[model samples]
Target: MKPEFENIPLIKNEEKKRFEIQYNGHFAFIDCKEMSRQIALIHTEAEPELSGTGAAAAVVEKTLMYIENSGKKLLPFCPYVFAFIKKHPEWKRIVDEKFEGYNQL
Candidate 1:
């Protein structure tokens, strides 16, 4: 069976080394490095203060989407990212084969 994936809008910011997907002014960021990929769930202090809304999940989703769409591999060094991949088996194909041990993290 396939799991349901929610539709979220992701904002790409290549200059910041991240691709941000925002919702209700809160966002998740995927930091891309030349060597590896990292995901972070972050919130800002603005009109709507979103301090820890599990935005990281969206980041993970966006990263996986980007990897799949671009034929790139993901090396998730972030613990949150590692867990996201572990929980979502459907996204495993985008994960780097070298990251097989990510389940342990």
Candidate 2:
């Protein structure tokens, strides 16, 4: 169930507090909030047009890359992100060990 994300631009839009992929005039984004030095992924959404299009996984993968590259830790409160990490265990390294859900991953 891999998503096609290699060509998309993943943007960290701090003004709106999201990591987004703008596609065909709409956005698929991971809404986030900062807690200390950790970024908590709060929600995930895609326009109706992008629903069921693997956009969720695509956005999650890119956001994980952003977190890893920026040397930031992740708190995946969003279910989709949690599931994605559960499926791709390698990304678990970027998650904050103190997160209550970390044991589940």
Candidate 3:
């Protein structure tokens, strides 16, 4: 059976520099760094059990929505986030063009 991702709450844990979600007894998160009016999405991860269940995508989608609604630009430094935006061009509106090819380690 597929894991349910609906109705999950994404939490912006600024103290930890990551947005987090609790699911099935595990925690999934996306690391980020906020600077001025831009936010750099640096990394994303989910528990092994959450992998392949669309949890990562959900987190990224919600994070992007938050960024858009907050009127901040996105610097997708995380490969997953960059790829996600590439696949979903609608999100390009919030992406910082200057950082289009930025994938730092």
Candidate 4:
């Protein structure tokens, strides 16, 4: 059966260098580093209880949207983020080309 993910809010906590969300009363986050022209998605994690609930996907999707709207490129340092971009080629438009091996990463 498919699991329904709640519409949890995401926070771009620049000071903490991460995008955050609260899920199942626990904190989930995507670690990141923002540079002058790009943002590097370094890691992603969700509370164990929130696993398989779509919290990670939700955070990544919203983070990608935010990066697109901000007109900045993406540096998917996180394997999960890279995989997400590979699956959604449309998002590749915002990715930096120099990271030539993005798919291999």
TM-scores, all candidates, are 0.66, 0.90, 0.88, 0.86
Candidate 1 per-residue lDDT, tens place, 1-105, comes to 112225666666768767666667555566666443533323211123434555656556766776778766777666667667678777767766666474563
lDDT against true structure, model 2: 0.88
Rank ordering of all candidates by TM-score, starting from the highest? 2, 3, 4, 1
TM-score for predicted model 2 compared with the true structure: 0.90
Candidate 4: clashing residue pairs, number = 0
What is the lDDT for 12 in model 2? 87
In model 2, which regions exceed 4 Å deviation?
Answer: 1-4
For candidate 1, the TM-score is 0.66
lDDT of 4 by residue, 1-105 (tens): 123443566699979889988766876789999998999999998889987777888788888888998899899988888898877788898898887665553
Q: What local lDDT does model 3 show for residue 57?
A: 87
- By summed lDDT, the worst window of 10 consecutive residues in model 2 runs over 1-10
What residue pairs clash in candidate 1, if any at all? none
In model 2, the clashing pairs are none
lDDT of 4 at 22: 77
**Model 3 superposed RMSD (Cα):** 3.5
lDDT of 1 at 91: 74
Count of clashing residue pairs in every prediction:
0, 0, 0, 0
